[model samples]
Target chain A: MIRLLAKPVSAVWLLLMLATGLSWWLGLDQGMSSDQQSDYRYISSGLIIIAFIKVRIVIRYFMEVREAPLALKLICDAWLVLVSSAIIYLYCLGPVPVATGG
Target chain B: MTSADCFSAVERKVEIKPHVPGEVGVWVFILGDMLIFGLFFIVFVYYRGLNVELYSHSQATLNQNYGAINTLFLLASSWFVAMAVDDMRNKTVKLAPVFFPLAMLCGLGFGVVKIIEYREKISAGITITSNDFYMYYYIFTGLHFLHVLIGMGVLVFLWRRARFAATQADVRDGAVIEKDMVLIESGASYWHMVDLLWIVLFPLLYLLK
Candidate 1:
C-alpha cells in the first residue's frame, strides 16, 4: 500500500482532485445580487483555462503520455492549445445578435 | 521491498527509449476520439456564444453537486487504473487485480449519479428538446455515458487478465508477460481518455458562467 502511494501517479491523482474542487468552487454563484450587470468573462475564461490544465495533467500522467515520444507529446499539446484558445476566444467574444425578419 | 527502495528502483529503471504506453493504433484511436470531442466543445461554445444569456440561464438549472460528484468518481477511477498499471509493471499482479474492480465500482458510481441527475431533470420536464443547452447536455453526456459503459467492460477484461496472471505460477516474478503489456496499456489508455474528456465536459456544460 505504501508503495502504491509512493508512486508519482498518486501525487498526480491528489493534484487532480484538488483542481476539481477548485473548479467546482469557482463555478458556484457567489451571492452577487447586484442589479448592475457583472462581467463574468474573466471568471469563465479562468474556469475553462483551469479545466484544460487539468486535462493536460490527465493526459500526461494518467494516460502516461509523459513517457511518450516527442511526436505524440507535440500532438497532444497542440490539441490542448488549439481547443482551449478557440473556446476562450469565442466565449470572450460574447453574444452575437441574432438575425431576425428573415 | 520498502516503498523508498521501490521508488528508487523505478527511477533507476527509466531508460532513454521513447516509450509509448500503449500500441500505436490505440493512440491513433484515442487521439481521433479527442479530436472529435474537441470539435464538439468548440461547436457547443460557438452556439453558446451566440446566446450567452440562454446558456447561462440553462446552466443555472443544472445541479452542480451532481457534476462535481461525478467528476470525483471518474478521477478516482482513473487513479485506481493508473495504480493498477503501475503494479503490473512492477510485478505486483496480486494487488493489481484488486484495483480494477475498485475502478469499476467508481465507474458504476458515475453512472448511478448520472441516472439520478437525469431523473431529476426529466421529472422537472427538462428534456433535450426543452432548450439548446439541454440538447447539448443530453447528447454530450449521453455519449460520454456510453464510453463509461464500454470502459467498465474493459476494466472487467483487464481484471480477468490480471487474475490469470496472478494464478500463473510459472510466470517469473508474477509480472504479466511482455506480449500482454501492449493490450493492457491500450485498454488502460482508453479508460483514461474517457476520464479526460469528462474533465472538460463537466465544466463546459455544468459550470461555465
Candidate 2:
C-alpha cells in the first residue's frame, strides 16, 4: 500500500538528514584550521563509507534488485562491493601526482 | 440455451501472457549503460589519486548540506518508484499517479537545489576553470544532475500514461497495466542508478577532505 511505503521512505530521509547534519557539524567543529588535516581525512572517509552503505540499502531493497534474476542480482551486488572497495583503497593510498614537478 | 452460452463464453475468453521477456532487452541496455558509468567512475578515482590535494581542496568548497539533502531526495524517490512498480504488479492502478509524482517531485526537488547550489558556486568565482578540483566537481556533479533530469522526464512520461489509462474498462486495462509497469520499472532502474552514483559522488566531492 502507498501508506506502507511512505513510512520507510520518510525513515530513509530522516537517516540521511542525520548523516548530513553530523557531517556538517563535524566539518564546522574542525573549523577552517589547516592544522587538522588528519582529522578531516578520517572524518570524511567515515562519512563516505556510511553514505555508501545507505545507498546500497536503497538500491538492493527499494529498487527491488532482490526480485531480479539471480545473475543480474549477482552483478549488481558485485559491482557495489567492487566499487566501494576500490574507492576506499584509493582514498587510503592518497592521491597521485598530476605530473612531474620541476 | 444455458449450456450453449457456457461453451461460447469459455471459447471467447482471452488468455494473458507474462511481460517478462520484453523486459530482458531493456535490462541488458541498462547494464551496458551502467558499465559505461562504471568506467567513468574508475577514471575519476585514478585522477583523484593523482591529484588528491587539489581534489580535496575543491571538495572543501562544496556544500555538504546540499549534497546530503540531494542524496536523501534521490533515495526517497527511488523508494516511491519501487512502490509504484509493486502497485502495478498488484493491479492497484489508482495508486500509480500518487507515487509516480512523488518520485518525480523528489527528482525535481533535487534539480532545483542543484541549480541554486550551482548559481551560488558560480557567483563565488569557483567555476570549472577555477582549478583542477573545480573541473572534476563540475563534471561529476553536472553529469549526475543531467541523469536526475532524465529520470524525472521518464517518470513524467509514465505518470501521464497512467492518468490517461485510468478511465478505461477492464478489457483495455490489461495492456495499459503491462505498459505502465514496463515504464515504471525502467524509470525506477534509472532512478536507482542516479541514487547509486550520488552515493559515490557525495563522498568524493564533499566529504573528501
Candidate 3:
C-alpha cells in the first residue's frame, strides 16, 4: 500500500520539478524585457496551476486524505479548491486600487 | 478526606499519554497560521501578475540557483523526516539517532544557504523595501528561515532524548515507545508543513517568470 502511493506521489513531484526547470529555462531565454509582460503572466499562471495541481495530489493521496472520513476529506478538498479558485480569479481581475485623487 | 489525602489522589489521577495537549493544540493553531500565509501568497502573486515587468525585473535580483538548491534540500529533508517518523511508529528507536541528526543537518544546511543568499542580496543593494517584490521576498523567506531554526532546535532536543531514552527498559516497553512516536510524528508533520510551504514559495518567487 505504501509503495502504491509513494510511486505515483514521487512521479507527480518529479513532473512538477521538470516543469519548473523548463519554465526557468524559458524565463531565462525570454530575458528581462518590458515587452514580455503578457508572456510572463501566461507562463506564470500556467506554472501556478501546475503547482496547485501537484499540491492537491500530494495532500489528497500522499497525505492519505483519501482514506480519511468522508466529511473531513470533503472539507479539506473543498477548502483548497475554493481558496485556489478565488485567488486565481482575483489574479485575473487585476489589482483594485482605492480612488483618492479622482 | 484530609488535605494530604486529596493531594495524593490528585497526583495519582494526573494524565500521561502519547499525545501532548500542548503539541496537539499547536496543530489547531497552525490552521489559522496557514490561512494567513495563504493570503500573503495570493497577494504576492496577484501583484506580480498585475505588474509582470516590474516583478520579473525585481525577481532578477534574486539568485535562482540558490533558491533551486534550497528547494532540493528541503524536499530531501522532508523525505528523511517522514521516514524517521515511520521508523518511530515501528518502534525502531535506534534509527532515531541516525535520522534525527540527518534531519537536523539538513535544517542547518538550509539556514547556511539562506544566510549566504541574504548576504548576497544585501550586498547587491536590494533591501527589503527596495521594491514591492523584495518586501514580500524578505518577509516570506525570513519567516520561513525562523521556522527552520525553531524546527532544528526541536529536532536536536528530541534527538538527544530519543538516544538516551532508548536505553531505558521503560522506553523499550510499548508505552514510552508510543509516546515517542507521537512526538516524532508531530515534529515530522511540522517539518513537512515547512517543506510544503517552500515548495509553493519556490515556484512563486523563483521559478516563475
Best by TM-score: 1
Residue pairs with clashing backbones, model 2: A95-B49, A96-B49, A96-B50
lDDT of each residue in B81-129, candidate 2, tens digit only: 7666655554535766788899888888899999999999999988989
TM-score of model 1 relative to the true fold? 0.91
lDDT by residue (B1-209, candidate 3, tens digit) is 99999875554322333233225555555455567778888888778767866876788777787877786677556555655554454443556678788878778788889999999889989888888899999999999888888888778877876676456424435456665555665566567667767767877888675
**Best-first order by lDDT:** 1, 2, 3
For model 3, residues A31-91, the per-residue Cα lDDT tens digits are 5555545565566567667666756654543343454456646655675776667666766
Off by over 4 Å in 1: A35-39, A96-102, B1-16, B169-176
TM-score of candidate 2's A chain against the true A chain? 0.64
In model 3, what is the error at residue B162, expressed in angstroms?
Answer: 3.5
Residue A95 Cα positional deviation in candidate 1, in Å, after optimal superposition: 3.7
What TM-scores do the predictions have? 0.91, 0.79, 0.76
| Residues B1-209 of candidate 1: C-alpha lDDT, one tens digit per residue | 99999886775322325688878998999999999999999999999988888998999999999999999999999999988877666554667789999999999999999999999999999999999999999999999999999999999998988787667524654434445677888999999999999999999998887
Q: How do the residues A20-43 of candidate 1 rate in per-residue lDDT, one tens digit apiece?
A: 999999888877554312435566
TM-score leaderboard ranking: 1, 2, 3
In candidate 3 the C-alpha lDDT for residue B92 amounts to 39
Which has the greatest lDDT?
A: 1
